[model samples]
Target: METDVLVVGAGPTGLALGIDLARRGVAALVVERAEALFPGSRGKGLQPRTMEVFDDLGVLDAIRTAGGLYPVGMLWQDGRRTGEYRMFDAVEPSEDAPYTEPWMVPQWRTQQILRARLEELGGKVAFGREVVGLDQDEGGVRARFASGEVVTARYAVAADGGRSTVRRLLGIGMTGEAVDPYPTLVADVRISGLDRDNWHIFPPGGAGDDYLAICPLPGTEDFQLVARFPEATAPDLSLEGVRKVVAARSHLAPESVTELRWASDFRPRAALADRFRSGRVFLAGDAAHVHSPAGGQGLNTSVQDAYNLGWKLGAVLRDGADAALLGSYDEERRPVAADMLGLSTRVHRGETRRGEATRQLGLGYRDSPLTRETRTHPGPLRAGDRAPDARVAGIRLFDAFRGPHWTLLALGDVEAPEPDGRTRLVRGPAPGTYGPGLYLVRPDGYVGWAGDTPAGLPDYLARFGRR
Candidate 1:
């Protein structure tokens, strides 16, 4: 058939994009190769910045209801409690940066929430449709699936996980080194006699080859089990095999793990794509970058990728913006993905702690070509910085920035342009937010352009087809 945008893969990335497109009144379609949503507890942590994103997407309430805060880590030795290990550096919330810690929700549960949101916004996923071949020109891209259905769209996005079929079809190459040599087994299993209040870790001793961790998944009856094997060894994924490993490493008996829901083996590696865009096709999520699952950056970064691209796509497709606006997606996201990959590797290798860097609240496109900083000297919040949360004149900055529209904050006598329906004008006193400047906030909650006056504001608005 035909659509404005074709989103391949129904994982968190594609579903989030579909929701964004749907709310923008764009005709988008999402296709998935699997018969149902992903069933696993992988990618279980949502970073703080991602929590803000979820808040904007209208899923934060459901997500918070379905998940809980990560519990403290309980170290175990010889079947006895030894000491407590804090998994992340403690940080209090601030008026500028909220969501100080990551939230715990199984990846499957997170996907379910996103899918429900997509459906609520008038979008649906086409399952059991595997994309076998793809061809794109200057106008649009055509996708042929295994079911003999050919679909055409103005643009296409690849969010089909690390082993992305679309990336392989486009001949995109991923380059990076293996982060760890030990094989890892991750599974969701039902267990007994373990308190659900803390994450239990059995460190490797002289007798054991490696370590095993059992983390109780919030809002579920299962605990996620992660075990490491010796170098060059392939860990078994069978139920009996996991039972043996758990009994050997932890204090719990084999029968304690009563049911095994899902399990998989993987080698932790970090890799980034050679390019995020190829002609009319774009890469997102694991299709573009692969992380070590440390610092919980992979899934969060993937969702942000969709968040970054969604508004641009809406602008070009529906708002009469220039096609060149799309180029900023790669210019802005690639470097952030590279930095996150490095951060995940460092966290995995014990070279760093889960401190401020892992929070990802500071990531921005300051160097992107789209960011225009026109001022004698900018203050703390400049062009390309994340628009911090604040309340000015009874108007919450985020509330004004919500939905698919840009916000121009005329703070403290800064001359601002008259906002129309598409552009929201929020005038307020300086809560010391931007130090008396006109801040142009993008739909994605980034400071796109900032100036002391409305001198170059018209030109900036014209770039996005805004009047």
Candidate 2:
């Protein structure tokens, strides 16, 4: 195999997977059809859970610098401010959840940051290499590119977005519905006569008029504009067209629309592939599941998919784990994607608000076959739940958990395991979230197994080919 893993599409999912594999010393390749990284602001909102994921991936500091908090929504009518619209329920930061809110970074900037980090780790993305077809044998998978090149890898992943070429070639069917039939235009533009303090909202002027929104893209001189049109009406993509929409929908003049950086139209939809895996290949991100932009779940869920699969792929390729360990990826992630699809649809149709659930901190893998709850009685942070970050005796839990190793947090004399370089062992007093027990945090920051003693710990470690 030319590489251990072949990641298609250099969006957030593929870049994140590349970064994880590079850190684990796995030889991998990332290919993108586009000439450069995605130059759009489609998936701009990053949830608190994803912030934690980035923290572990070593990009949180740069991500924090590249974005700002989501501003409060401002309502307008007749060129006057009517009231304030809360885009998201505000939450305060705590010791367990330091990143309480979603950070607004343009998707383009996020991809650039991930690409830079990948290169820093000696991994690079080959742009303009489009995979046209793929075939896999017992040894490995071969991806045929449009440039008449065949790239082989032990395994391949499809992160090539919703209309994934890999998925289509593999004949995976996506079952979903159109969340909104109305055509919507999302664009990145530069406009004046608007304060950057709030996300400006222009409500429907007449009975059949459409609503428009202009949000100042943080850390840049761009404003993301979204306008909803009636059914069967196609949005105009020209600069004059965007200026007309701004003038008609808002109080700003046509010329106030200084620059139309990028614009695209789509009908909001929710979809999930029939299967997350096919032989030597697996699907991820938009290829596995497509979500509505409402509630900001699509991109966050996509990144989490990478976070879940990265470690498993690393275990099998670099750690000599059984290939059966890879089966859990489909089992664990498919259900989560199905649930998030519902959540995104609910948030899109106004059936639900962007509440705590949207933050994704409560998501877990309790039913996953890999999760083990050996303890008779469990605390609030149990097996299959997200391991809450805490500070025990001046040692930050997240700081200790920030690496490509399994962490065994043995609290209060739980017969700590023998030292091993593969898994880091640490002992401390149990915090409030975790009562008194042994907590095993997975590399992806989830509590994989919990017990009162180290009775079944060795077997569990051996199952994943860990020492």
Task: Mark the regions of model 2 whose C-alpha exceeds 4 Å error after superposition.
Answer: none
lDDT of 2 by residue, 103-164 (tens): 99999999999999999999999999999999998899999999999899999999999999
Query: Scored by Cα lDDT, where does model 1 land?
Result: 0.92
Model 2 CA lDDT for position 43 = 99
TM-score of 1: 0.99
For each candidate, what TM-score against the reference?
Answer: 0.99, 0.99
Superposition TM-score, candidate 2 onto the true structure:
0.99
RMSD in Å for all candidates: 1.0, 0.9
Candidate 1, clashing residue pairs? none
